[model samples]
Target chain A: MSLLQQLRLGFRSLMLHKLRSALAVLGILIGVTAVIWLVAMGEGVSYQAQQQIKDLGATSIIIRSIKPSEESSRDVGSRFGISYGLLRDDYERIVTNVPTISRAVPMREISREVRHREYAIDGQAIGCTPDYFGMNRLTIARGRAISEVDMKGYANVVVLAWEAARKLFPIEDPLGRAVQIGTEFYVVVGIAAERTAAAAIGGSLDARQYDRDVYIPLSTFRARIGDRVFTLRAGTTQLETVELTQITAVVEDMKEVDATADIIRSLLQRYHKSVDYAVVVPKELLEQAETMRAMFNVLLLLIAGISLLVGGIGIMNIMLATVTERTREIGIRRALGATKGEIVRQFLCETVVLAGTGGLLGVAFGFLCGPTVNGVRMAVGAFLPEVWSALPPNIRNLEPRLAPWSIIAAFAISVGVGILFGIYPARRAASMDPIEALRHE
Target chain B: MNELQPTVDREIVASIVGVSKVYKLGGHTVRALDNVSIDFRQGDFVAIMGSSGSGKSTLLNLLGCLDRPDSGQYILAGRDVAAMDDETLSRIRGRYLGFIFQSYNLIQQLSVVENIEVPLSYQRPPLPGGRERCLKLAELVGLSGRLGHRPTELSGGQQQRVAIARALVNNPHVILADEPTGNLDTATSHEIMDLLDALNRAGRTIVMVTHENDIAERARRIVRLRDGRIDTISEVRPALPVVSGSIALERL
Candidate 1:
């Protein structure tokens, strides 16, 4: 028979039992959709993490000081109780000595209660410089940030975190208004835009959250609040000395950070007795982020693979049942001068048709799932722009990536699965005794 | 008993020396055919007669190359068909053997014209004269009126007619009929018998295996088989003065 006629016959045979065919195709459909969606989700998450890490400045290196333990302090510099940790000279020395050092910004964080009239909020008070604005990706909502002149002249000005500003003064313009901090009132120079928290990349540093932070110049902080400071407690006359815990730096040339950090380490080694100094390169975090992405991809592929397997099983099931139903038909064809090869070809054609239809439908379902899922998320997100604003740069700009070769591959594999499952039944039909088949009801 | 199977050789035109077919059911073995043997030359018209279980169908299958005897040599047109392998048997059946069964085993999906093409398909190059051959066969079998009708769409008699045309398509040396009129009424049976008679007169060899004595009487020679053995073979002389058919004697 001609190929066209064979196809027509196959289609009609399938249509004869509509429910059975649909059930078979459904198995394939579910499997295919699962594969596409799971892979997409895993890829989406890993991609989001990578960009977040890259935004941390892939080329940048960070150096923070670590305090020495009691054991290390007992020998050498520790014998005289020469304190270990970030010395003021370490910062000044790197700036002056490192050849590739393009620009450097130092930051110190402290917790203080800022009060404006009746409202007060406890937040992190950060000591930073002019370059900190551009390095930390801080955008101004209103007013201006501390400039080079402000850091040089030790200006008593501060920048309010978006959430900090909202909590302390909900309806009022906090810009240019003075807020009390540790008995010293500072004017709000600018309001920083809120940014999404950095995802955990590796064991290097904790995630940086911009929600509850305040920025101030390092020079101004050193002048107003010296290194040796103490706070008094109620009823006990207890004193708490503020120890500088973290010094976040942004180097101008990202490539120089590792070598620069090593130099600073050796310089600090001569004067220090503690292991309290930890130099971190944000690029390491980027590497960890990529590793995570690779792991996620493998996981997604596994999930997709399971679904495809199920779909193949479904095709196998359907084809098996179909062979039984068409037993008599097959016998009749054989009797009517059709060879065993012809019979095989006819049934194989039927399976190809089933797979072709199911594969196309599955791909379409998978393609459409992204939009439908995203639409629901967007609908719910209407109530909160803050959450939507933190959406990763990749997903915020919607794009439906259609891998053409994958579509074709999926189509071909579906059909192949059908045929593989179809063999036993086709052979059964072909091997039947023609005389007995004629006598069969 | 000595006639268990026919003697087999390379040159015998058609031989059934001594063939015995036994069917085993549980511990009991029933003999379907009992030492039957017979011989006939090419282009000879012969009929087999017996009651149910008398092995008429078994004998017919042996003649048509559809089944092998338990013990017998069946030589057909100079070939030892009984000794041939299944593939050779199938090929031989395709090239030379033709069968007309009682049920008229025409495929329901195929039209009358397509049904006639079944045996012809087995031809190596598929003997040419595609449409013209189909038309001639249809006209020969009086199926010109319903060539396009499927088997179910046609009457039992009409379907049998298509089966006959299919049998004749390959232009084989021998034609085997197993109760070809078993399902047809008396008139239709007689009509089909007349058609067979006309073809036989035109030099086509026909073998009819039937229980009906009346059907046996139509043939030129009669062979009676019982207990898987041939009991008698008698030349039949017709009692009636025959009338000619309206259809012309056309060579396919």
Candidate 2:
């Protein structure tokens, strides 16, 4: 028989039991939807992580000073006011000795109270060169950031972070206004824009919040603070001296980040006797992120495949029942001169049609991932404000990213499952004895 | 019987020699047909009648190519078909034979026209003008007006008419009817028999199996089976001149 004719026959048979056919289609629909929805969510998460790593500067290496252990502190704290950290000389050496490093920005920060006419807040007083602003993706909202002339001339100018500006100068113009930091007065030159905090990436890096910070020239900081500060405790006084807290070395090319980071680490190990610093390469983290995304997608696909397998089993069960129900019809067709292969083809066609229809519907719904996720979040926010507020910021702001391959792969697998599961039942129907089938009641 | 060959004349449409079919019901073997032989010529209307389990149905099944004999040589249209495989049997059935069942065996989901097209769809070197041919057969079987109706929507006699149209749609060499009137009322049975009689008179060979003697009498020859063997073969004479005159008036 012509394939078209067999398909027509198969369609009519499936239509004879509309409820059963619809149920089989529903099984496949759920499976395909799960595959698309789960993969989209996974892609969204991986994309968010990779973006955070990229924001940290994919072609840069960061060296941060950490407190040494008690045994190592004995060698460093023997002389009072002799602190251990990234030195100013070390930054100069990295810039001059390392040919791969295109630029190096040194920064030092200390927690201090700032006062602007009785509106006082505790904020970090930061000293950095001009390249620090662009390297950290910090934008200036008003006036201008720390200029190279300001650092070279040792100008006493400062910039207020977004939250600090709001706290200290709520309704007043703060730019060019005087703010006192630990008995020293500095002029506010600019205000930094608000930025979302980046999440911590592994144990090597800590979470960074860019708001509520004060910026000034590194030359001015050394001249004013003098690299010596004494804190009065409950009974005794502690004196500490630290020149630079961190140094960020940017490479001309992304491929040279690992080589530069290794050279910097060896340089620090030779200059500092105690282990008080860590070198972090963002390039390595980016590679790890890519590998993790691949593994995550495969795991999600396997889980989705299991659901589709269950859906295929449902199709096989229904097909087997349909064959039993239509034994007499099969006998009639055989008597009308249908071959065994034609009978098998007829049943297989019905299953493929069921799966194909379900797959098309699933792809249509898959595109709704973004809107659906947002709608659900809005509903939760409206009904359960407390629960919504408790969710992590990442979850609150998640945007589902639909991967095109998931749509194609899920659709192909569903149809393939239909054919694979259809074989046994179709064979059973084809192998039935004509006399016995005709006698079936 | 083993050495029997085809005769020079090609008028014989089918011949069977020493065909036996054995069925094993659980552990016990039942001989459905035992050493039976028969011959049917072209343009002949024959009926084989018997009681239950008398092997009439078995003989019809073998002749229809729905099954094979345990041991025999059966020839149809100058071809040995007893040992043919399924694919060959299906092609032979589609090309050279048609069937009409007692229950009207029409597919419930299909309209009368689609059911009529069923056999033609199986023909290789596919027949063109299928819809036109189906419509013509529907007119021939007096079901042209009911071509779009499903089997369930038709009466028993109308359904049987649709079955007859389907049987003739492929224009096969012979039509096999198993108790064609077994499920119809007497008036409907007579109407169906009249249709068959007209078809036979129009030079189409037919083989029918019926238990009723009156029904068997409609055919030109009646072969009776008893205990899995042919008991007697009888040739029914034509009707008297009065009946012939009535038939002639009816034809007018």
User: Per-residue alpha-carbon lDDT of model 2 for A64-103, expressed as tens digits?
Assistant: 8776765777777855744878898899899999999988
Best by TM-score: 2
Q: How closely does chain A match the true chain A in each prediction, as TM-score? A: 0.76, 0.86
**Candidate 2 — which residues are off by over 4 angstroms?**
A1-9, A67-85, A110-125, A137-142, A160-174, A178-185, A191-214, A223-243, A272-275, B1-10, B237-252
Tell me the alpha-carbon RMSD of every candidate.
7.7, 4.8
lDDT by residue for model 2 (B114-218), tens: 999888878887877889988888888888888889999999999999989888877777789999999999999999999988877765678999998888999
**DockQ of all models, two decimals each:** 0.18, 0.59
Interface RMSD for all numbered candidates = 3.4, 1.2
Off by over 4 Å in 1: A2-4, A57-150, A155-198, A201-318, A378-410, B1-101, B104-155, B158-179, B187-209, B213-224, B227-252
The TM-score of chain B in candidate 1 is: 0.86
